[model samples]
Target: MLVEKNLPLQPFNSFGIAARALRLARIGSEAELQALIRHPDWSADQTFVLGGGSNIVLTGDVRQLVLKVEIPGRRLLRETERGWLVEAGAGERWHDFVAWTLQQGWPGLENLALIPGTVGASPVQNIGAYGVECQDRFDSLDAIDLETGEAFSLNAAQCGFGYRDSVFKHERAADGRGFGLKGRALITRVRFLLPKPWKPVLGYLDLERKMAELGLVDPGAQQIFDMVCAIRRAKLPDPALIGNAGSFFKNPSVTPEQCADIIARDPKVVHYPMPDGSIKLAAGWLIDACGWKGKTVGHAGVYDKQALVLVNRGDAEHPCTGGEVMTLARAIQTSVYERFGIRLEPEPVVL
Candidate 1:
């Protein structure tokens, strides 16, 4: 394993914010990772595990060593009466992996197609879209303890998957109240459990519209996959063209009474009642209602197409700083809270 110093991070993250890592290492295999933990010079340096860099915002130069996961491979490991069991290395691009699985006739991940990031990062955020969450199809994952240099695995429940959250997002303390893997575990591989007799998930209104437009009562998996991709492409700007993280904030959930209170004032508030007693509010609607869409603050701006996304209006010569992004984000949060009486939580991991 080679360790490089003073590496530029501008190209590593999706936000396209200019930054650098004090030291960086590209890890392609488990053995390489083991070597890193055992290396006398680099082993003890504080480190950060970077996947596809799709879900992170670099505020400034990162002092810690950055481990860029590059593990690669994909295959159907086994099949049971229940479904097909597929395994992909942590480094595989999430969207490409979804396409590969569909090409191989595994259809469960179609709803999540077109999401940016690596397979390893998927479980960390419990990434979801349309109507499916990673927890719904996750089987297990292999991760190495950053502290002990030991390999371990966790199932769905062990992952503690919640809405845009997982155990990996927290930290352990002396009291043991918040026990999270956080920087303590580096994911090496991930496995997916795509069930047998795959069925379509077109419960979302957008998907329903696509099905109706196509005049198909039952759309196949591939059809659904194409539909999701098309919908995302139409609604969300491509990062290569316009630098951005897919969604800027999580769709905040509220109680039924709170929903009624908001609806009483604004009859057009978009919301959906959940399986539980809570109701999920459309964060984008709240932001749009507060009049932040298509507004620019310095180099950071809200995406005109979708209010939920924040974009970088900068390029090589003059780029947007992460602080500006955060400033704009905070302003949006303040406005939404003042108008709706609810706090808006940003979705990206700001570093």
Candidate 2:
């Protein structure tokens, strides 16, 4: 329950944007959070829950009271004949948790390896890589209502999962039809259901290339994890080295007719047919097609290797501001829209 004032936030966020939290508190357990809620000066509306800070853009100093979640633990909750139910504290590093699950002989999360952020933030973003998403293996999560200080749980359906979206991402509807949690709930623990008789997910192009190169007809979970990590490292700059939130934009989905129109203009347009009738376009291909790679704007720049990534080009002394990053992102969005008539939505949460 200790509060710090004017806390530096550059190290917390992946973008390395220079910013500060006006007041920050560390919440290490459910009881601590409840105690904070019961404080005389506590205001739920003025607080912001921060996890790994790996999926956000800080436009300026955070005026909201920042609650840095540091609760930590992981264990096999239960094992059934069908699958293994594993649980992790909200503050656990997502990549480390995935690797741990694999080491313990649990298998569903391999394809999502190397993704940035915390377990608490995973479902909020419905994080996905290759062909697997958090919702694919989600069992449920424990959270506390900030206003009421009441604890609750939600299954996958209650999460209302979508492409990089969940109930946590939207504001509560006025009419109550939307039923979003948004700023009202703080996730504490997440449970994952990793099924038995596990089979690797190997549908993405990069993975297929690895299989072909290695002559791997039946690669194991660990092999897929290794390949995913290698591929991501090859294309994305490590946040430790270059400040970046991986894949800045979400792949836009369009109608088949729209895809046909783009294909007619640029026959090389990269796209994949979804299980639904919609077609998902490669956002990187669109940005690259518009000539954005290696381009810089102020202190923010597009990663030279991956057009989908927006990076901080400045050093710690003269770091990029969230404004510069958003400016570059907007410019890229405008260019992609003007050329392809499709709007690219950024993936990171902008604050």
Candidate 3:
């Protein structure tokens, strides 16, 4: 294991936030991970497990070991009547894993095509897009307990998956003890239950429309996957070319009664009733309605193409600082809350 100091973490994170780490360690195997955690330098307050760094905003230099998990491999673990259970290393790029699964004929992950992040981080936030969340297919995760070297397999329920929140993300503090905000539970691997049977979830209207345009009647999972990629490419900016963390805010889901009230106030509110009868309103529409689309307060601004995404428009003198991003997010939150009585929450982990 090579441990470096004062490492630049800006390039690692998708947002391109200029931040450094006091110490950085890249562990390629479970043994190495355990060794580092057991090292004298390790502490609950000074250890952080980073995956792809796609869903985070760094405010300043980290005073800890930004441990980047590099373990890699994928395999079919089991095959039952329902589906084939596939397991992958936590460090695997989520999009690459999705593509590999599609090629291997796994059906469940196709709808989640093109989402940026690592496999381990998927369950952390129950990462979802276009009607599919990680919890829907999550079987289990092999995670290392920071306090104890003993490895434990956490089932989906054990992970406490919630809307953009999980046991790893929202396990907060009340009085004292507990991991609270900064815990070092290292996710080593993730297992997903997928099916060989082609099940196409064409719940998103844009995807359905695309299928219709292509004359696809009851398309298969792969077809849906291709369409989703096309839609995403047209809608979201590529993080490689432009720095962004996909939808910066989660679409606020409210009760049907609340939706009715909002609809009465502004019929233009775009909302879709979820399976549980909860209504999910478009975050982008809300932000745009608040007059933030294509608006730039500094280097950080809302993307011209998509209102839901905040972009770091390459440092035109005043680079996109963390403070500016926070300010814009606060403004949007305040406006949306005042207008619709719904408070929008930032999806990214702001440090």
Candidate 4:
């Protein structure tokens, strides 16, 4: 483990939030991680496992020791009668891995192409897009307990996967049955089971529009990957140029009766019936309806093109602080709640 003092965090996070880690340690291998945990001075310190920093909002300098997972490798473990089993290191870039899977003739991960963060962070957030969730392809994962320095493995059921949630996001129940990994567990590697007879997921609205625009009936994985990348580029701002998390709020789910009430009041309210019978409302539409798009508060502003995104209207010399971003987010949430009686939850982890 290589240790650094007062590490600048702007380059690490996608939002480019200006902050610092009081102490940071980069663990590029399992041995390094184990050695660091064995050190008497550091073993008891509070540590945060940081992946790609894409899904977090650092409000201030992190007081806890930051353990940056950089352990890296990728390989096809084995092919089963049902599907191809692949594994990647905790620190591997998420989007690049998806693209690599396609290049190697694996078709299942194409729909999730171009998502930010690392493979280790993927399961924690249950990252999904275009109708394919991590849980759908997740085989299992390996991790180590920060306090105990003990290694353990878990399958999908143990993950407690939900919409943008998992065991890693919650605290362990007092009864200790449902384990919440969260800060306690540091993921080392992730494995994916991409099934055979891979079928295209063309049910998403953007994919449908792409198919119609191209005058094609069926699209392949590469085509879908290209289309998703194109659509995202057209809609969302690149973090390299503009600092922002992809989506600011979760699409609030409501019952059919509740959906009807909202639809009755606002005829143009956008919604879709989920397979589980809940209706998912468009959070961006609600925010746009409240006139938050393109509005600026301090260094934070709502993206005009897509109200779902919040941007950093600051430069390297003066980047947007996490406080400003959260303040703006809270305001948006309150407005949406007051107007529609629906509480909008943020997608990113605020720290």
Candidate 5:
């Protein structure tokens, strides 16, 4: 295992925030990780596992030992009577993996195409788009315990998935009642169970509009993938062109009564009824309603096309700092809360 000191992190993160990793190591295999765990300088509490860096915000120089996961592979693990089990190394680009699965005739992940990140980070965020979430197709994952250097596996239930959250995002309670993995685990491989007799998820408004425009009553998996990519491209700015982490806020869920209250005040409020009876409000609508689109706060600004996205308006020479991004996010959150009485939680992991 080789370690580099004072590594620049501008290229690693999607937000293009100017930051550095004081010390960094690349773990390209399970053996490398285990070896690092046994290193004399190794400290679990002082290390941070970095995947594709698509879902994170680097607030400042990372003092932790940054372990950049570079493990790479993908294959069809097996085929069951009901579905196909596919596996991918943690470092595989999520969008490429989704497209690969579709090319191989698997259809379940089409709706999640074009999402930026690594497979290892997908479960940590329970990454979702349109109407499908990673948890819906997740079979299990293999990980290494940083403290014990022990290999283990966890099924979907063990992951404790919620909206853009999982056990990996939280720390264990003092009494050990909670099953939070947080920084204790490093995901190495992820397995997905793509069901046979696949059905497309077209419930989202953007997707429904695509279907109507194309006059596609029953679109195929590839078609849906194309449409999703197009929709995302039309709405989201490419990280290469404009530094962004896609949607910056999670759609807040409220009680039906709460939705009714908001609707009475603003009849045009965009909301969706969930299967669980809670109502999911469009976070973009809320931010737009608060007049945030195309607004700039310091070097951080809201994307002009999508109010849900927070972008870095500065160039590489004067990149936006993590503080600026968070400041703008906080301001948007405060405005949304003051107007709608609903708190908008940011989707990115602020580190």
Candidate 6:
């Protein structure tokens, strides 16, 4: 274990919002994670779990110790009659894991290509792209309770997954406070249930239309993976190159009645009703309708290619500050709220 104090975190987060942590720790194994949780000097409430740090923004210095998970390993756990179950350490980069699974000819997770973040954070947000979310293929995960340093496994149902949410994210105390922070449960490993029978999901109009134009009746997992990568490359700016978290806002899910009312007001309002009866509306369109496309304020600006993504247009000599990001975020939120009577929440975790 290594511990440091007053560390600057500009290199850690994708948003590039400069911030400092009071203390920082790196754990190399699950046992180390458990030991840190049990350390008398460290309080669960004062510790925060950090992975690849892609889906996060720090508006200010983190007052607690940021524990970065360094444990890394991946392998196929078993081969069932129907599919293969693969387990990966939570510290693994999400896209690398997805590409690895594809190399093995695994038939799931292809639609999730190029999503930023780590394996552990994947379940926290039910990370998804194209037309598939992580929950669709999640089997289970091994987590540690930060208070007692006890390990436990949670099945998919126990995860309580929803659009960009999970029990891990929505954790609440008996008094309606937050859990995980005080308990310090860290996701040390993730298990994925991948189907052997290839099921290409092209439900999104862009993908479905592309397939239709190709005159293809059925596409395989590899083809879908290539198409997803191409589409993502066309829209999302690679964090390694431009430094951005993909899709700064989630598509707002509303009630069918709400959707009907909005549609009556503006037929251009696009929405799709989920099987669960909730209607998902395009946040990008809403933002664009508010005339935020290609809009720039100071060093922070909305990406011209995708209104859902906010980019840092500032350079090294004039980097965007945390305040600027928050300011722009507030403006977007206020604009979307005024337009549709619903507040648009930022998708990335704003620390």
Model 3 lDDT tens row, 164-183: 77788855566766543237
Off by over 4 Å in 4: 43-45, 174-177
Kindly list the per-residue Cα lDDT of model 2 for residues 137-217, writing each as its tens digit: 999999999999999999999999999999999998788777788889899999999998898899999999988988998
Model 5 ranges with Cα > 4 A deviation: none
Candidate with the larger TM-score of 1 and 6: 1
TM-score of each: 0.98, 0.99, 0.95, 0.97, 0.99, 0.94
lDDT tens per residue, model 5, 62-143: 9999999988999998988889999999999999999999899988999999999999999999999999999999999999
Query: 162-205 in candidate 1: lDDT tens per residue?
Result: 99999999887768766688888999999999998787787898
Give the better candidate number (1 or 4) by TM-score.
1
In order, the Cα lDDT scores of the candidates are 0.92, 0.94, 0.84, 0.91, 0.94, 0.84
**Tens digit of per-residue lDDT, candidate 4, span 22-70:** 9999978777887888888775338888899888899999989899999
Return the TM-score for candidate 6, rounded to 2 decimals.
0.94
Candidate 3 lDDT score relative to the true structure: 0.84
* Model 6 C-alpha lDDT per residue in residues 69-160, reported as the tens digit of each score: 77799999999877999999998998899999989878799899888888988999899877788998999999888767888998988888
Which segments of candidate 6 are over 4 A away from where they belong? 174-183, 212-215
- Roughly what TM-score does model 2 have, to 2 decimal places? 0.99
What is the clash count for each candidate, in the order shown? Answer: 0, 0, 0, 0, 0, 0
RMSD to the true structure for each prediction, in A, is: 1.1, 0.8, 1.9, 1.2, 0.8, 2.0
Looking at model 6, which ten-residue stretch has the lowest summed lDDT? Answer: 176-185
Candidate 4's clash total is 0
Q: Sum up the clashes in candidate 2.
A: 0
